[model samples]
Target: MRNLWNLIVQYHIALVFLILQGIALTWFVGSHGYPRGKWVQRSLEWQGKWDQRMSQWDRLTELDDLNRELLAENATLRAELHTARRDGVQSTYQGAEVIRSTWNGASNPFVLNKGTAQGVKPGLGLLQNNRVVGRVVEVSENYALALPLINKSMEWSVRIGPTGPVARLVWEGGDVTRAMVYDVPRSASFAPGDSVVSSGFQGYFPSGLLIGKVADETPEFDGQFLTVPVTLAADFRAIRYVEIATVQGRMELDSLANSNGQQAP
Candidate 1:
């Protein structure tokens, strides 16, 4: 303690001088308008920069939450539209993220981040951007598998328009952007630009859900029907988010059809 006191006594003069200097500088700045104004301006500038950086950080942190909210909103809107269609059943929707997908394969299957826990089940309809994407075929606790329209084995029941003829749309294992509509009657009147949509007969998507538009390719006559080429509206390669539609009473309807030894139209 005595040695510390001696050390303090030795440097006390310098400490006192430094303290006095600091006080003098403070007083000089306060008395001078120009110096004080410059100091205030610098302080404000530093504060503004710091605030901007903090705001950017906060936005970055909230981005994921914002995306989830958007997905929920979209699902609600879709459900409302489905109900408005009055397709003989009430429907609900849930949004999901596509974790994996394949477009260039014969049996193009995609995986979703939602499953039975989230009300996702087999035979549910998958939609993206208000257009039909696929149908859910399998499910686990937290994930589901779907077969897209690009799958060679997948055939969708689609119509040419709101009241047009219904035909089977199938992928012929070549182009990923196109599919062929078979069993279209030769008497059916449809142009190249007509919008093909779901017929709601397959028990997947409700009627009027857009599948694709008729392409400019010439229809090929196959005996009794005209096979038309269609340009698919959904881009399978870029699908990241989708909505799964669950039609109420669909299971009961399917069971009734099966009991009668027939398929649900």
Candidate 2:
């Protein structure tokens, strides 16, 4: 208490001057409102900017939630579409994201984010933007493996667009960028730009899904057929998502094969 009294005594003059200056400032501002009003307006403007930044942060948080909800809704709609198509009803197929790609000769397989749980199954046709990508060769509870068009063992029945001829699409083990369309007649008059599409002859895929365009054509060893080289429509190296085509009457094809004591080639 003695020290406090001594310190107060030492600063009493300086404190008196500060109080006098504050009183004079208040009197000056109250007497002339323009300067004080400008200061108040500037302070309010600064506060408004702070509030705007906070509002932007809140909006970003809301947008993130909206995006997640939309993704879930999309998945649900796809499942319903698959069910409708399988039941022989006309409906749109769902798009599934590609979670992994194994194009490095590891059986030439890819993994999709959806699986049997999402109505995906083995032998279902895989497509990208209405172009044939491949087929589902393996499935799990939450994932499925796809055999891309580059797979050496992959084969499909395809027909050229509009006026072109039908042939068997097969991949040659040596060339990854090119595939051979076999059994096309030499008289089909194929050119370098004919579009190839699925024939749906086997009922595994819907007819008219694009396969590729003819990059070149040459006579085959048999001298009666032409080997039409196709450039794949789907760029396997850049594929990000694909649609799984659930065709109607898949079971009928299976039954016919079983009756013949044979499986799909």
Q: State which candidate has the highest TM-score.
A: 1
Q: Which stretches of candidate 1 lie over 4 Å from their true place?
A: 1-65
The numbered model that scores best in lDDT is 1
Every model's TM-score: 0.74, 0.62
- Of candidate 1, the 10-residue stretch with the lowest lDDT total is 31-40
Q: What lDDT score is found at residue 251 in candidate 2?
A: 76
lDDT of 2 at 156: 84
Model 2 spans with C-alpha error above 4 angstroms: 1-92, 217-221, 257-265
**For each predicted model, how many residue pairs clash, with residues at least 3 apart or on different chains?**
1, 0
lDDT for each residue of candidate 1 in 94-157, tens digit (9 for 90 to 100) = 8887766777767777767776677777789999877999998767656676788887766889
Instruction: Note the residue pairs that clash in candidate 1.
Output: 201-265
